[model samples]
Target chain A: MLQQLSAQELPKVEQEMTDFITQYTTQEDLKKSMLYSIEAGGKRIRPLIVLATVQAFQKTLNAPVYQTAGALEMIHTYSLIHDDLPAMDDDDLRRGKPTNHKVFGEALAILAGDGLLTGAFQLISETTLEPTENVLLIQLLAKAAGIGGMVAGQAGDMAAEHQQVSLGELKAIHRGKTGALLTYAFVAGGILAQQPAYVLTLLEKLGGHIGLAFQIRDDLLDVVGTTEALGKQVGQDEKSAKSTYPALLSVAGAKDALEQELAQAQATIEQLTKAAGFQPQVFQELLALFTL
Target chain B: MLQQLSAQELPKVEQEMTDFITQYTTQEDLKKSMLYSIEAGGKRIRPLIVLATVQAFQKTLNAPVYQTAGALEMIHTYSLIHDDLPAMDDDDLRRGKPTNHKVFGEALAILAGDGLLTGAFQLISETTLEPTENVLLIQLLAKAAGIGGMVAGQAGDMAAEHQQVSLGELKAIHRGKTGALLTYAFVAGGILAQQPAYVLTLLEKLGGHIGLAFQIRDDLLDVVGTTEALGKQVGQDEKSAKSTYPALLSVAGAKDALEQELAQAQATIEQLTKAAGFQPQVFQELLALFTL
Candidate 1:
């Protein structure tokens, strides 16, 4: 069901994202580099998460929601570009294409990433949301994506490379690096829909569970999934000696953990829908998409 | 007079910047890396420009104004951190100390820069400005600091390395790279003070002139100033074979161009003050600080 929704909405998200990026498309090489990354297609999961969550509230998609979705994708793309830099992950390919630095050189790649990150804020600020809501959304994004959030997570991950990290330490790193932005998508949808405080809390809880589950699944895929399927190198954790869920927990144990998280997420959504006196069928479908 | 005002407000700007950054100060190495760059202070020129511009409009310093100033400084610091990365300029020294990448490694240095940039928007969004004004400020900062602004400028500069560039191209690069944010400082001050559109235009024109003059002076200093006095490597442009005003125009001609920019900036301030029916003494003092 969520796949169908994603398929329906993916074109719209891509169009909106292209439109937003075109605003900066001058004749410069910098603009070309920036557009190159955005045009490189992904599953568009982040924007879909945003749109699906908004739909779960029975709210029709609006400009603010679409703009937020586009901004989130830009942020995600920027992170990928920076992560693929020579000083970082050093990947030569991403999403079956030459990485940003491979196409635009290291300096321009870095600048393109910088431009996208800063441009995200500009997109949100220009949205037609109520001022108070706009501020809240911006605050949410900055906290999730900024210093104490994803950036810090990336820093921790880098520092822990080739080192033995405990499960607790690994969880902390994943929470910041992978979990923050995912959770922000749900929370942002709730904010846009004007969900009650209780619902917002439930959405955050659901996001946490789903985020952990998503990371665990990713770890499993890196170990088992093909580079063809994954669209990039696999078993990188083993190669780099980076810690992973399957490393800390056995494969079976990791699978067990993933199931537990999915269950928790489902329970939270159930409780939230019950309290709100409506079934969020779209959210339930989204959870299904996460299942193997 | 400008120096006196900067001295008086410098500590306050430092204090506010420290306070804003402190919010992300965890025991994590990421936080330490971020702070390392923030604490290795420069002359705090950007924030002072913001404060002085506000004073030009006869406005008292307030929380929003100060926060914006601090945020501007953070953005400036972030740019310095990235520019000094090994993948970029490969500088090991900044502000008379080891550069961020030197102390924290390339990965952490990149993350720290990302943190500062994203945190800057968070700082501004959390300010107490009216929603309209806050959005406008965010838009201005994003435009001046994002693509088609500083990032584009940096890209052009990097691409021009070891190559010939026309005077027009040089000015275009400096306009985006150096002039955008400097001009944004004045325009931001005007927005915060509720100045009219005409005054805002004058501020932007003033910013463009000063920004160009500032870059020319920087190039001149590279030719004449010692590394000890400059607090960084000297004669880098010549070493890297990057074009500069001093390269395109002779040293004497560069000095003449700088003088012309100063004169144009001064004239704009005079016209602005005369039209606005205010003395704009603070602006005059700021112009003096740039005159050398």
Candidate 2:
């Protein structure tokens, strides 16, 4: 089911993101780096989750919200660009190609990342979302992306280099680095739909749980999967002494945690599914992406 | 006058920026990088320009625009961080200290730069300004920082690297890269005051011309100023084979161009100052910053 939906729906998500990225970035070098990082090709999962989550909430996607979803993908792309920089992960390889810095050189890569990151806000602010809602969404995105969220996570990740870390510490890092933005995505969708604050809070928690599980699954896969299968250098986490769930937990234990977290995430959405005006298929589809 | 004003006002600008930066970043490594770049320090000229521009416009010095002004300095700081990366100019020193990547390592440095850039948006979005004005301020800020402004100019600079560039091409790059944001500062004050579009437009033009002269002066200083005076490594541009106005035009020629541009910029503001609601002294004070 996951494969089937990704095959059908993921392509549309990629197209939408490509269209959005191309709009603000037209410089050849910038386009080269943006396409290099963005088109290097992943599952386009974040944006799909956004689209699916919005659909599940029974709101038709409007232009402003659609643009916000695209901006989320750009933010995701920018993170990848920096994560793969030589000063950071320093991996020459990403998604089976030379990393952004490798292809574009370091200065352009840094600027490309900077451009992508700043460009995301330009995309969001320019969206025609209602002023108050737009302001709220901007705040949510800023909080998720700034020191309180992604930056904090990155700081923690950097600090963990060559240092021992507990499972809880690792979870905290992933939760900020990866989960904060994901949580913001769902909360953004909920806010856009004018859902009640209670619903938005639940979605934020659910998204957070899923984002944590996603990172753990990624960690586990890195230990077991080939570099080609994972789309980048695998097992580098151990090389870099970077902490991961599988590094802290036994593989069996990590898998068990993922299962528990996944169940909780599903339960949150299940309640919504049974509620009036919910779209169960979207939630079901999102869960299926990870279960496989 | 310059030294006295700079001494009194510069520390406040530096302290405000430091406070804003500290709130978002505390990872020791990230802080090391952020501090390495920010603490390396300049005259706090950009933020001072912002505040002085506001003061010139008759706004109280303690107005909320001060926060917005500080945010602009963060953007400036981030640009320097990226520009000094191994990929771009590859400088190890900025303002006489190790560059961000040099002191903190590349990864943390990269993230620190990212943190500052993203934090700027977060800062502005969370400001206590009203939504209507906030949206407009963000639009102006983003344009200045993003593709049509700073980023675009950076791209032009990169493209022209090691190549022969015309005086016109150089001016365009400087205008976009440096001038846009500086212009945004002047226009931003007018914006916050709800100044008419015509007034804002005049300030914008004034900023553009002054910006060109500022860059020209900078290029001239590269040829003449000591490292002690500039607080950065001297002659780095010539080493990089990057073209500058002084390199493209003789020192005397560049100086001549600066005088012409400065005069034209002052003339435009002088015209605006004569209007009933417009204040000539405000613009005269702003222009006087460059004259000495």
TM-score of each: 0.95, 0.92
TM-score, first chain, each model: 0.95, 0.90
Off by over 4 Å in 2: A1-23, A225-234, A239-241, A271-276, B1-13, B226-239, B274-277
* Model 1 chain B weakest lDDT span, ten residues long: B273-282
Candidate 1: which stretches are off by over 4 Å? Answer: A224-233, A275-279, B25-27, B224-233, B275-277
Compared with the true structure, all predictions reach lDDT values of: 0.85, 0.76
State the C-alpha RMSD over the true interface residues for candidate 1, after superposing those residues: 1.6
| Predicted candidate 1 versus true structure: per-residue lDDT over B177-234, tens digit per residue | 8899999998888887789898899989999999999999999999878989767778
- lDDT (tens digit, per residue) of candidate 2 on A1-292: 3455467655655565567657655456776777678777776677667666677777876666667777788888888888877767677776677888888887777777787788778777887777677778877887798776888898898788898988778878888899989888888878777787778888898898889878888888888789776666678778777777777888888888889889999888876764457777777777766752
For candidate 2, list the clashing residue pairs, or say none. Answer: A87-B107, A107-B87, A107-B88
Clashing pairs in 1: none
- lDDT for model 2, please: 0.76
Tens digits of per-residue lDDT for model 2, B108-183: 7678778888877877787777876777777778778876578878887898987998887888788878998898
